[model samples]
Target chain A: MVLLKLFWSFLQIGLLSFGGGMAALPLIQNQVVDLHGWITLKEYTDLITIAEMTPGPIGINAAAFVGVRIAGVPGSIIATVGCVLPPFLIVLLLVRLYLKYKNLSAVQGALSGIRPAVTGLIASAALTILILILWGENGFSTNLESLNFVAFILFAASLIVLRKWKPNPIFIILGSGIVGGAIYLLL
Target chain B: MEKRKSIYRKLFSSTFYISAFTFGGGYVIIPLMKKKFVEGLKWIEEDEMLNLIAIAQSSPGPIAVNTSVLIGYNVAGLVGALVSLWATILPPMITLSVISMFYSAFIKNAVISAIMKGMQAGVAAVITDAVLNLGSNVAKKKELISVLIMLIAFIMTFFLKVNVVLIILFGGLIGTLKVVLHERRNKGGGE
Candidate 1:
């Protein structure tokens, strides 16, 4: 039953999470944290942290982590499969339809309209992450003032370099870790 | 026969490499695809690549998966799509399986934790930049309406903790209605 629940919950997440990993965060958080009580908020935070550091998409990582947490290896497989299945199915259907109506203006217009909405979804995702990072569990307390600005600077700088230069993300992630460990030791 | 064999080989090789290296899911795969398929192989022109991205974005699947299918199809039809999809998913599936095996030990590592913190900040920025670039490109009245709808959905889900499935359904309904109404107006004007 727990494995089934994990499968069903992640399946729902996969079906609805349109804008990708970052966009999937709040939904996954609500599921794991609020609905099932499978994981605590801190654990969710840690999962996000770990997912970001790891090699796959955040949504997939969350599924793997939560799946393992709930029902072990099988759980992970179930969750991952559940999360991936919806998109795969949906795309297959859309591809068929697209091949049929390859030049319909209505289809074209509808797609154009969706572009902005998708962008909006992406923005909302960014806002949610920002709030989580800045406010933490207390919801906007004086604690945010204590954020490691130096760490923030390094992060921002590394990202800027990444954007302009298009360096490999793995390098950036690993290098940032080293820099972070050094900073942690120094401070 | 020789020509067909070469095409199959190319398709398999491209799909295999993409599946192996793509970490962090679909979006991360986009840049890499741009590098490999567009820059490296010249399989698709930039315009076609951009159009594929736009289509993938508006479509109902994971963007990376969708793109791989589309690109693969464009290159070698159904066979290509199948190979690309398999390739795209293989790496993560294998990696996740291994990671799951040692999940507890991996999570407890302090150095991993520190690195994750740093990467989280960077990932956040990447997401932010994507939003900004997208917003700048598509910021108009209709776009604003879409943005507003998105904001409402976000607030409802994140703050009010409403079900995200409902939010997506509602967005889909609104999008459908807007398109239908616009089409009707256009028809009326034509008539």
Candidate 2:
């Protein structure tokens, strides 16, 4: 029953998470954090951090991470299959049809519509993730006690670094982790 | 039949290496896929890869996995698709399993906890950067209707809290209408 639930929940995420990993963030967050109660909001954010550091698709990594935490190795397998199965089948079917009518204006037009919407979806997902990071459980508290200044600074610094140097992402991830660890030791 | 088997083997091995090694998700994996498939193997042409990318993005699922299935299908059919998909997901599944075994220790350690907290903020920023980068690129197309669609989709998701599925469907409807009207206008002018 547990395994089945893991598969079904991830399958929903897989089917609905259009665009890419970033776009999929909200759906995954909703399913695992809100619906299933498999993990807390903090744990989900931690999973996201690890997913970024790991190789392969973030969506796949996330599924495995959450699944293992919830059930075990078997859960990981089920969740990974659940996540991969939808797109695997759908894309195969799409390719078969798409190859036949690759030039149709109507098909092209629908795709054009999807293209811009995807950008918007990605932007919205970004905001949602930031909110999750900054706000946490409390809705809104302007007091410094509620805010995490260190995290906000890191967020802004990482953005600037990413835009300016365009360094390898793995390096940035590792670098930030190290800095974070150092800060903890000092505190 | 034998030739098909070799192609499958090659597909699995190549995808396995790429998926196992590439980090930072879909965008990073894509260029590596291009190099291997287009330049190295000559399995697909440059423009075809671009088209596949478009389909991969528009299709539901992870882009890396979607692209793998598309390329595998293109090369070796259904069996190949299965093989490539397996290869793409294998690394993460295996790695996460290992991580899970040590999950308690990792989470409990003070340094690890702090690092994760800090990294979450960094991850958030990186995501923002990606959003801006993708948005600006799409906006650069300078097509008014497409730009309007993008804005609408953003507003719908961000403010109205609309379900993503509906926004995508509505965008497609508008897209189809735009094309049909444009085609009619062209025909009427020509006649």
lDDT (10s digit) by residue, model 1, range B21-126: 4445565566556656776689887535644655565554367767777787767777777777666665565565566567668878877566556655555555
Query: Measured by TM-score, how close is model 1 to the native structure?
Result: 0.65
Per-residue lDDT of A100 in model 2: 90
Binned by DockQ into CAPRI classes (incorrect, acceptable, medium, high), candidate 2 is acceptable
In model 2, how many backbone clashes occur? 0
Candidate 2, clashing residue pairs?
Answer: none
Best by TM-score: 2
Can you tell me which runs of candidate 2 are displaced by over 4 Å?
Answer: A1-79, A137-145, B1-64, B67-84
TM-score for the B chain of model 2: 0.62
- Model 2 C-alpha lDDT per residue in residues B3-91, reported as the tens digit of each score: 98899999999999878766566765765676679867999985477557667876799999999889998998888888999999999
